[model samples]
Each structure stands twice: as C-alpha cells, then as structure tokens.
Target: MATDHQGPATMLDVAAHAGVSRATVSRVFTAPESVAAATLERVLKAVEDLSYSPNAAARSLRSGRSNTVALLVGDISQPFHSQLAKSVAHVAEDRGYSLLLCDLDHSMDRLQRLLTVLPLQGVDGIMLATGDAIETPGIRAAIDAAEAKGTRVLLGSAQPDSSMALTVSPPFEEIGYLATKHLLAQERWPVALLSGFKGSVVSTLLRAGYLRACLEAGHSEKETMVLDAGFNSTSAQRETAKLLDGAAMPRGIVAANIPIALGAISALADRSLSVPDMVALVACEEVQLAEQLRPGLTTAGTDIGVQGEAMALALIDAIEGQAATARALVPHLTVRESSALS
Candidate 1:
C-alpha cells in the first residue's frame, strides 16, 4: 500500500517514489506548464501509485490562496437549500476547489461569528443564502473585512443591497404573483396564502407580490387571507385546521414554499375534500414532492440548481477579479392537477 505510512501519504512520499525532488513534484502538480512533460508523467504515475494528496492548509500557507469556497445556507432541510447545496458542491469540486457547506439553521449569531473568522482562515470565497446572513448589520463589516483580506462574496438571493453585492436570485416576486394569479384565474373567490412567518424578507416579498396581483385584479384584503405558520409543515397543519374550523374556507390558496403546500394539502385531506374539486391549490416554488403527491401540485417552477451554480460562478469570478453578476431567473408556472377546477 503506497499510503501505508499510517494516516495518509504525503507529497514527499510521491516525490520520493517518483525519483524527483519535492519542489519538482509540487511544480508538476501546481504549475504543470513549467514542468517537463516527462517529469509530469512520472509524477502523475507516482501520485496514482502512492495516492498522495496535497494538504490544502499547507498549500494555502505557502501561496496565500485556499482554493476553497464556503457556502452558508440558512437551512439544509429545506428542499431549495438542499438543491442549492448539491449544485454548489458539484461545481466547487469540479473546479478543483473544496467546498464548505455551513447550514446555520437560521441562526444569526452563528452566521455573524462565522463571517468574522472566515477571512482569517483564508477562505477564498463565500456564497451566502438569504436572510440574516445578507441582511444582518453585523455581516457587513465582516464582509468588508473579508474582502480586504481577498475573500470574495456572493449572495444566493436578491435583497435591498443586491446592487452592491453580486447576487444570483431566482424569480421570487414573480413566483408569488404567478402562483397567486393561477389561483385567481380559477375563478376561485376568497384566496389565501400559507406564507410563512411575518417579518421574514422572503415571506414578506412573496406576500407583497401576491397582494399586488390580487389588488390589480380588483380584489381587496377583505377577500384575501394571509396565514402564518412559521414555515413549519406541522404548524401549517394546525393553522389550516383553525382556518377550516373557525372561519370560512378560501376557495383557493397559495403556499409560499413546498412544505407549506404539502401541509395545506394534508389539512385539506383531513376534511375529506379532494384538491381542486373542493379548492384550488398552488405553491410558489416547485419541488420534487410537488410532482410525487397524489394531486400533482401546481407551482411556479424556479430552478434552484441554476441559482446555486450562478452564485458559485459569480463568487469564483469575483475572487479572480472578474466582474460577474448573474441575471435574474424567470420562473414559469407548471399547471397540474391541484389547481384545476373540478
């Protein structure tokens, strides 16, 4: 076993095995253009046989570059974040860079602390998901400090400060408007929204878009209901029960996220009312679950993987001093069984 020295084979092991100096081995791997093709072949062979890997820490210390990108997502459990994480990891690894995925679970304090130290640790770039990571006041100084230390930053969502920072955003406001409009187009009176908690930037924007569409269609708040369940499926269930039990049920509902949509469907099932037959349903964002459900969910189809890759590329370009900002993704509605009138 070439890596038999115990933990892992070092670069020196490959160098020794290849009959070359450690510097030659390093040059062959890092600056192959400067190394002779014959030496490169020998080193590559030795690298394969010894299975030796370069230490990122040592390389960063020697070159002042980490060749790593960090992605901070608010919640990995969310379908959107999970997709974003997968794409970011894939692209980072493909580009010969290590990826650090940090799921903060929506903790602002933890994100602030992480931002504070990312520069000192020589992280090459950062990809931030929405919410406190981009909106919190503490993160600005940290971002500035990191930029001064040569760590580039990109955001996964659009915000008020988006013009100042590179951002890759899906068609957010349009998604809400499209989903709500689809519900309204069914001629379903008294529409509602399962739009997460109040004061959330995402939920707020989505709600505003929904409201804008409704108002334009001559509907008022009296005919529109916005329900809050803290973005939890179980909470949405309870809220749905209260909505059905205590008040008149809206003819149509728009779920701000896939989870909320699932919860809403479950709640409706509890009442033995079939989707679209009893009430129309649509979700602002499409996910895998939307299609797999009994009544395929009508949704605003936003490509999350594209959003993640766009941000990753933007961050990489920024790191390399190339100005790159992604274009906003336009969402298209996917009509399905759930929103059909029965």
Candidate 2:
C-alpha cells in the first residue's frame, strides 16, 4: 500500500504498510506492551517509513482527552530543573502522553500567561516545578482558573498546603541543614548560606535549615550569615566577592545549587583562596560535573529522577480522575574533596 506524499499518512496506511490489522496498529500506539515484540517493531518501522502521525483531533474527540501534559519550570538551563524535566518527560512518554515543556524564565508574568494558555490549549494536566514565587496570589488565581477549566494541576517543589493539589519535591530544609552541618562538623565556624531569593519558599526553607544547624552548634542567628544569591551564577559570584572582602570571613559556605556553587568557586579562585584549606564549600544539590571539577563538590542531594517520577504519576492520577497525594523525597550528604578538612 502506498501512502500519498502530498497529504498526511493515516492509521490505515500504516496498517497496510506493516501488513497488520488496523486494530494492531492502534494497539501499537496505545497499548504497545500488549503487542508482540516483533509486531510492535514492524508497526513502528511502518510508522517511520510512512511518516504516519495519529490524528490528534480525532483521537481527542473519541477519548475526550488531548493526551498531552504541560510541564512548567523556572529555569530549564539549571542542573536540578533540567534533571527533573528529563525524568518527567521519560515517565510521560512511557504513559502514552506528550509533554509540553514550558520555561517560566524566572518571570511571574510569564508563568501567569502560560497558566492561562495551557488550559485554553486543552492539556489534560500540568506540572509546575516552581523554584521561586510559589505563593503569589495571581498564580493561585491562574491555577484556580485552570482547574475550573478541567485541567488537572500538580506542583513540584511544593509542600502540603491548603490548596490540596498533589505536591512532590525534595526535602529542601533538610538539605540545607545537612549541608551546613557537614561544614560545622569540620569545626568550620561562621558558615554562610549563599541562597536564592529571600522570600521564596525554597529559600525560606533552606534558611530555616541553616539556622537550625547554627543553633545546634550554639551559634545565634546573628552569628551566621545568609546572602541572597538571586538564583543564578553571576549573582552568586558577586555576593561571594563581597563576603570575602568583609571583616569577619566565613570558614564554610553552603551554595544553594550547582550554578551558585560554580560562581562561589570562581570568586574564591579570583582571591587565590584554596578550597577546603581556606573555605570549605558545599552545594545543596549535586550535578554531573561536581566530581569532575578540580576538587569534587560536597553536596546534599536526593534522587531527582524519583522525585520527577512521583510528580508525573501524581498528575496522571489526577488526570485519570483519582485523588492525588503529597510526597517529599529525602536528601543525604555526600562528602568530597571540596568540603574535606585538612
């Protein structure tokens, strides 16, 4: 059977090309695990050869679903967000759903606009990986509107709150506490937390953890420092430089994330300061390049993949008309050369 090159290929064309029934082709797209491996392979090959695409509009009409999910993140370029996106996308694909990845670009305005657009576009569900501005009233209004339009929503990096939507995230406060404690255990005094925006939920939680560690060491809140690093490398670098030039220098530093850690490392290098000897450094999350650097990064990290998978499954449960629940993954400290005491 020959498919017309001028128009789009259909399921029947794919079935003819693969020498299978139309139902077999449908099974290949919908429930592939039920099909024989060889038959699945043949149908996939036929789909590739004919460039066959399922008619989404017809499918939507038949199933009353768009079979698509949207993912919103503050910054996809960062290590933690990127890793989470990858894990969510993998799980979404396996569940026979398409993922629409949206970058908020660190803008509340953009997030608001996208919140409106996604429901309008008929995505079955939404997963927001919010790193900042999680408590804005405008965002809550947008989410309410989206839910009113019948789009299920899930919030990543969120705790169990009154809104009652499914939430999945790492234990941010614990990460902060453990990272700071790792430095304190080495007898590094006056440790500082190079953090994200001050008022954001993540920053606040991490600060709480930092304060907890400080108090445990018999240090008051005034004894420790918390600098706003603005959720990026450049800001982190600038703040770190100021800290280094101050009268009372910190013996240990807890960078909020990998990019911030990189920035702090750059600032230390500019001052010709040796890591671990002059100032021990630790990051709240681990990245792939952590170990490859001059000295391996000491980090407090959780399984990003596990968190993402949980988030995806929670959203899917809501999309399928089931009750979803909140989950928080635990974190652990990884000691490395950067935070080692000489």
Candidate 3:
C-alpha cells in the first residue's frame, strides 16, 4: 500500500499507481457500470491503496451540480421537525445527494435570509417548512429569488393557499376531525382543542375540523372550547394548568400535537386526575413515544417519515428538470388507552 504524504492523493496519482488512464479512473467513479470488471477491480484496489477519494467541489464544478440539498425547518428540536429532517436525509443519501439542514429558530427574519442564501450557495434543491412565515411578503420574495437562481424548492407542512413550489402537506383538518370524533365516539362530551399558536395555518385548520365535529355531533359553537397552546410542551403545560384551575373543564381534550398531549397529561396528573377515567385525551399528530406514555397517546395524523420522503423526492425531481406535483396526504387515527372509554 502506498500512502500519499504530499497533501493528499489525486486521481492522477491513482491512475499512475493503477496502470490505467486518468479517463478510466474518472469513468470508474462517474460511471462504474461502463467500466470492465478487471479494470474496475484494479482501480478500486489502487484507490484503496492510495487512500484516494473524489473531490466533491471539483466534480460539482465540472458537472454543474453541487449534489447537495438543503432542508430549512422551524425548530429542529421538535420531534416532528427532527423526524422530517432524518427522513429527508436518509432519502437524499440513498439518491446520491447530501442533506444540509438549517433551523430558522421560528424567526421570520432568519427564514427570509436563508431562503435567499441557501440557493445562492449552489444547493441543487431546498425543502422548507416555513410555518406561518409563508404568509409574509419577504419570505415569498426570498423564495422567488431562490428559484431565479436555478435552485428547485419544495414546501412542506404549513403551506400557503397558493404555493410557490412543489408541496407535500398533511391533512391537518382531517387529523383534528378524527381526534375529536374519536373522543365523541368514546361518549365524551364537551371536548376541547388544545392547539398551537393562534395564527398558524395548522391551528386554524385543526380548529375548523374541531368545530365541524362538534357541529356534526349536534353541539353548538358556543359549547366548543379552544385554547391557545404554543408550539412546545412548556406552553402547553402552562395553558393546561390554567384550564384545570378554571371552572367547567371539558370531559375530553384533543391536542394539536404530541407535545401538547404530553403537557396536558402532565397537568392532569399534577392535579390527581386520571386519564380516560375523568377526562379523555388525544393528539392530532404522531410521535415515536406516543404509545409509551402512562396511558398510551392516541393520534390521528399522516406518517412523518412518509411525508418527508415525498418532499425530498419531489424536490429532487424538480431539480432534475422534471415537473413535480403537489401532494396532500390523508390522516389515519391510531387508537390507544388515552382515548379509550374503558
């Protein structure tokens, strides 16, 4: 085995060492299927002996492709967003691309700037979960600017009515409907919705579905209770505690997400209230530990992994000059002890 002590071994070094032309070495990497078996084996052995690796930057420059994708998300610490990032990265790797994940920290200003900057950095595609920032003019303009630079874009989760890129979104309203309806089926009345921030498109859609279920159950709008719980467990816990302190607590609760459901459960336990015995609980979104709680958390939502895979593939298609279409995933309910009548 020969070690290149002068910086690092180049393709020329590997070509000379392997007794093959530099073109053959390039073909071995770029189109290994086109190379003969013995030649491929010889090149691979030489590459291993010389510790040779392709220069991504040089190849990208030659091919006019960076072989990189960026995923811009709001709060990657959240389980849902983190799951999305993992799923996208897995698919990107399988498709011969690398993923660059960025968190906006729920800041519109940061999102606006990144939307413009990532494309300029030569990312072949971008998948963004813009949250409520999608409504802003600056974000939209930034998205437009990114597209102008030949970077394909994909929008996920909370999208605007008219999307600026290919979108793969879950059926938020259906998730809420199914969660509330499950509680209602359990013979629980006066179900309340513990939703995310008030102005988010996700919250609004969930509220709409909650109200629809209440109405379908012959309950008036006045009978439905909706609480604003921010996007995390802390806010949800605080809000749930306040609700417990108030007069007239609903018999059932539909939480907008897994974090909200966990918070509500914590609040109930702190007050010595038993789940499904005194009050029933359900979450409109799914998480990995949904079934591991004291009483398993029931959820009604699309699989986050599937959603992420779809988003990445759509963006890659758009990047490769193919027309990409928007996708709307339907939600499915998973019943568990939290929402059970017995």
Candidate 4:
C-alpha cells in the first residue's frame, strides 16, 4: 500500500535531483551569474520537474540583498499614478528586480507604516510619488532610515528635502503658466483659475503662475479671475456650477489637472455652455480621456511614462552610488480642440 503522506518539494530536493548543493540552487535562482551555465540548466530542469519556486525571503536572507523595490504613491487610482506604476514595473523587470506597490491614499499614518514594513522586508529601494506637498515628519524619518540602511529612494513631483534624494518632475508652475498664457493668447482676457487643494504644492505654484500671467497681461487685480475648485470631479463640478450661477463668468478657464478638466467640462455642459464658443478651457495634465471628450482638452504636460522610467533608472543609480545630482524634466504644451476658437 502506498503511503498517503507526501512532503512538498523544496530547494534541497531540487539540488539533489540536479546533483548540486543547496547553495548552488540558491545561486541559480538569486544570482544566476554566479552559477555555471551547465549547472544552472540542470537546476532549472530539476526545478521545473518539481514545480519549485524560490522563496524570496530565504534568498534575501542569504544574499543580503532583496531584488525587490517598493513604489509608494498618494493615490493609486489616479491615471497618472497608475501609468507611472506600469512604467516602473516594466523597467524593474528589465533590470531583474520585482516591484511592490503601496498606496498611501493621502494618509500619513498609512505611509509611515509602509515605510517601516518595506525596509524590514528587505526592499532594495523605494520610489515615492506624493500627489501633494511632501511635509510629513514620518516621511522624513523614513527617508533618513532608508538612507542609513543604504537603500535608495527617489521622489517624483514632490518638493525636495535636503535630507533625501529625489528626481524633479515637470515644472508645475510652467504647466499652469503655459495653460493660462494659451488662453490669454486667444484674446480671452480675465481667465478664471480652477485650482486644486489649497495646500498642495502643485496647486499653489499653478495658482501663482495664473495670477502672474494675468498681471503681466495688464489685467487689474479685480479682473484677475480665480476660483478654488478643490480636487476630484465632484468638487470641481460643484465649484464650477457655482461660478456659472454667479453674476459673472470668465471668458476662459484653466483647470489645475485632468480630473478638474473633466469636471469643468461637465459643469459647462450642465450650463449649456459650448467650448471655445462661450468659454475656452485648458488643463495642466492631459490624459486619454481628455482627447475622447466631445472637444479635446488643450494641456501642458510632460510624458508621465518617460518620467516614471527615468525615476526608476535614477533610483537604481542612487542605490548603486553612481550619481548624486537631482534631475528635472521640463513640461511642454499640446494644443487640442477644446481651446480652438474659430
């Protein structure tokens, strides 16, 4: 009679089947270069037969380095962040590294816990993308600890702190300035600013740029139009509706980001306003949805995927101590149907 008990296959079983030591099997999986080609082939064949996958934790314990990195973002659901994550994952795979993603959801406490756990789990590096300004003490401490452990950290679209390493994102002020300036060039004076969160760094810079453009165009203080729409579509729609209901509405509107642009379009539709006929609209970041809208949105933006790839490469360099300079990618404007006036 056959016994019913059967133990799961392990690295030792694969090593025995391949006629190699346990260390050789570990090397075959973790550091393939360290194993001879013939030996690696044998080990791989044995692994396939046994349906064995290497244990990442055990390999990291023996190798003193985890071939894994963590990407932390403020809002994972946002189109920009989702695209960035995909880009990073692709690059990480090319470099023989795995990526772990964590969404902070704009919570300081959750971000802190992620930082704490990532290092303990032997993550080789971290990429941080905060939707707003980076000002939390927990974030600062996490950066310091990662640096102390010789783990690389890269930040995108976040203000740099002297204590941590970073890659500068597209100049948000430039995005805002260019969007508003485009409206102004169309002979649309007194453009209204539909801003994001009050304290967000991107919002502050964009707002300042819009105001500066108005001043440069010789618009009076009262005529330098502005409105705070907050973030997200619902808030933007509500704020924009209020503006439409008011006694006066600006001839042009500058939305802080893509989501705001979508909301602004909806609000205008509700008021039976036509794009570039009654009012012109411009947005800071352009996504696919913008183009699919009834009238494509004009926007000032940089390639988010390219930025993500650059950030990953930069973080790898920092991790290996090869480079020490902060890098910045510039923004460019794209003209679309929404801003066209015929």
For model 2, how does the per-residue alpha-carbon lDDT over 173-289 read when each residue is reduced to its tens digit? 999999999999889998999999865778888999999999999999988899999878999999999999999988899999888988998999999998989999999887666
**Per-model TM-score on C-alpha atoms:** 0.79, 0.80, 0.80, 0.78
Q: Assess candidate 1 and give its lDDT.
A: 0.76
| Candidate-wise lDDT, in order | 0.76, 0.82, 0.81, 0.76
Evaluate model 4: give its TM-score. Answer: 0.78
Candidate 3: tens digits of C-alpha lDDT, residues 1-342: 354558777888888888989999888765455677688768877876775656535335726778899998878887888888899999899988999988777777666656644654567788877455366778778778778767777778666566664777787888889989988877788798999895688898899899989999999998888999987788898999998888878789999888888899889989998998999999987878787777998889998888888898898888877776655577898888898766
The TM-score, computed over Cα atoms with residue i paired to residue i, of candidate 2 is 0.80
**Candidate 2: deviation at residue 212, Å?**
0.5
Screening candidate 2 with a backbone cut-off below 3 angstroms (N, C-alpha, C), the clashing residue pairs are none
lDDT of 1 by residue, 115-205 (tens): 6445545678888885432565666776776677677877776666444467676767788888888877777777888888865667877
Of models 1 and 3, which has the larger lDDT? Answer: 3
Q: Model 1: how large is the Cα RMSD against the reference?
A: 11.9
Model 4 residue 264 lDDT score: 86
Candidate 1 total steric clashes: 0
Q: In candidate 3, how many Å is residue 149 off? A: 0.3
Q: Candidate 4: how large is its RMSD?
A: 11.4
Q: What's the CA error at residue 158 for candidate 3, in Å?
A: 4.4
